[model samples]
Target: MPNPPRLRATALTATAVLLCPLLAGCGGDDPKDPDLTAQKLSWKDCPAPSAPEGGGAAPSPLPNGGRWQCATMKAPRDWSDPKAGTIDVALIRVRASGGKSQRIGSLIFNFGGPGGSGVTGLPAFADDFAELRTRYDLVSFDPRGVGRSAAVECKNAKQLDTYLQVDMTPDDAAEERKLLDGTESFNAACEKNSGAMLPHVRTTDAARDMDLMRQVLGDRKLYYFGISYGTELGGVYAHLFPKNVGRAVFDAVVDPTQNPEQGSLGQAKGFQLALDNYARNCVSMAEGCPVGDTPQDVKNRIAVLLKNLDAKPIPGIPPRKLTQSLATDGILQALYSQELWKYLTQGLYQAYQGDGKVLMLLADSLNGRNENGEYSNLIPANVAISCADDKPRYTVKDVTAKLPEFRAASPLFGDTLAWEMLSCSDWAVPGAAYHPNVSAPGAAPILVIGNTGDPATPYEGASRMVKALGKGVGIELTYKGQGHGAYISGNKCVRNAVDAYLLQGKTPAPGTVCS
Candidate 1:
């Protein structure tokens, strides 16, 4: 997989700004030292995101003129061995807009990716949470091995461009070998470039960092908004520090009950469902669908296009070609949000006419490639964190055996996602668990919102997360809608439910349904 499971938030735009360098503190502090928590932070005006942070300008001032502040917190490089060394955890925040008396504490957000840069992500979506900003300081960060926090480096830009183009789905022995070799090469590059950091980027370690962050931020409890993979991190945090959770919301929930294989399979079905929805919606439009006559016809055309591209690639953004993999990835990226359907339609139309630029652009976004052709550390960090968290490493034989089931689930996405099982096969570090432990019995009630049409993380994950979180702790809310997340969909019901809980501590009734 060229990309790991990531949030489908707005695309981050790149711009010029001053660079804020991370000054690594002198290491070798006492393992049991308590001074780190008491260390004061010198917050300053935000700077442009580093190359690893998808390179972007400093966050703009909030509507209320509250400037974004940037800071770095020192955390143990390895939670298991705190005395070893330390790494900087990058953070960004905007203070509450309302008066001091009305302020709750900081509400930290982790917008998924396991690799998404909160320092950049928060700014892009700040307006979406303007209401919450009235009472709580909006906070977010780049977890370790992500963005500028000891970012994991693998292949360079040129090599990455090549790597992403490799045929992910193998039809025969030679192709399977090539796939395996490519995966192994990628993993080896990670080990060569960032071996030490690889073993320490697990979700559990990140959860501990959050607790330390709570102490550093002077918050009595952790009030959090976690999306996509962020929800998994939140669950682990709740499990580790149940008493410290204040108010938490998990949108686009990841099922904690499944292993990596199961998760990938679930995604196959989810994406297929989203595609079906997209096709049906397109045909139902008053202007008539430009892509096809019927929903099945649309899908059939796409399948034919992918098959044709597999045999002979089409010209994309020049020098690069739109291979079957890129087109498939582009299609999956579009499925993340209903709003992107028009683009998908356009991309498909363009591809049919032998121009792959639009589809290639969509694929580029999914791969974290910028217009400059430089990549963010998204792919590296995602693979690093995922490998460190998951244990199972599938072999080619395993994937071959499961192909039929995957295909049945999603003929469009099956082979690619099934082959993605090999992502961790050659990792340097052993994974922490088959699946995360998220049974927080006494934790604060966390609002769990599920979007029925969410492609990346299926709706079924919400109830599974609820059950896994144990009784009375997870309040499930269903949004019968399209897209990857509920709150950002601009749905009043979801927004109100989430806002009321986060802003007023008034939890929505359990089993609430929003449309």
Candidate 2:
């Protein structure tokens, strides 16, 4: 299972394509490189995504006939030492539909994997933001150590296939050793493959890159949209460059206050809440719930299925069996969006019948594996950036000690997540801090949207972010809905409020609630 911090919007989209039809300088003075900043980006037609980017054909044109263009911006490899060598940061954008005078400059987006390729993300969901594109250029990029921006490669496809199958929730000493050995091996692979880029992949370094990107795009202030982990990045950017903040919105807000352990624990509760909601929805449906007669019954059946898989794995995709770990990952993926709920039901129905293809497919999506059996740098970069940003490293004892608390948090997810605390173990680079500092005291009012039922980031994170962003700097908008994000949930109120803020510069009333 992926660490709970990962947001699956882009990955989930990748899954749909397979099933469907074919498809910084450390703070201080702010590094300055006149030549690099003044250099012009040579925007051209985008080519098919590379293997590291989760390979696919180049993005198609927009509905308005505006072509999606790609480019690369140069930035220092290490922000702390601007004099160091440079690296390419891949970018993608489409011009605004509105007249030149009406254009409000570029509106950059970060779809929050810390590892997700904004280059692919912007185009995948371009239609949803077409309105924002009317007045602003829709722009996004592959941050360093992600996608084509000097991607961090680790275990190859074949190796990852085996690594991902290891029992993450080990029950005995031998099983625990296997889990630890696998983790160390994976971490070692990352060091062997991408050691040069490891230390510089921290959030602080990425934040610096964004400021340079702002200057290169000729935008006086950044007009931005961030989701999930992107929210954390945006907050860090705001803190580092409060004066440069423009109209920014953070949806599916991450709590800037929690350390990795607290964040993981919160996800345990959050996902459990979402599961409860999913069960209730299942039983209340007009067609009637097929999985179980009652909410608790549905959960009970799932528990039994998982326990059974742990003991005797079920046949999944050819050559691989659906183990308890993969099944849990598949379930987590389906729970990201309400639209995926039907697929979850279908997967569960098939699993009960001893066919694990659907569930395996879902797990494959989460792990960045496509139908072709190729892997993307998503998981690798996720671990790299997360380890670089998080300070704590766990031991087998640390995880075992916390198992009870984690299981108490969510019998379904606690163990898996607790075990994940060891993801940074034996990492190549030391982490920056316990938690990110998102205190942007003087930044412009950032519209923070939180979904009441968000599983990954949780709703309380909205208020926490608002507080962290400081007085008058953060605006909270509550969306009483489901899913990992609010705006993408297709809620009209959210769209209108966000559109009003980003397009017209009209900040929604603080503490605004949209149901």
Model 1 compared with the native: what TM-score? 0.95
Q: CA shift at 423, candidate 2, in angstroms? A: 0.5
Please write out the lDDT profile of model 2 over residues 1-515, one tens digit for every residue.
42423542344344334443200213424447897889899999999988888888888887669999999999999876778799999999999999899899999999877688888778877878988988999999998999999999989999888888888789899998888888888889999999999998988888888989999999989899998888988998998888899999999988888888888888888888889999999999999998999999999999999999999889999998999989988988888778878888989989999999999988888777887899888888988898888888888999899899999999998988888888887999988788888887778899999999988888999899999889999999999999888887889999999999999999989889999
Pairs of residues at least 3 apart in sequence or in different chains that clash in candidate 2? 24-79, 25-79, 25-80
Q: Write the per-residue lDDT of candidate 1 for residues 228-309, one digit (tens) a residue.
A: 8888889988888888899999999988898889998999999999999999999999999989999999999999999999
- Candidate 1 minimal-lDDT segment of 10 residues: 15-24
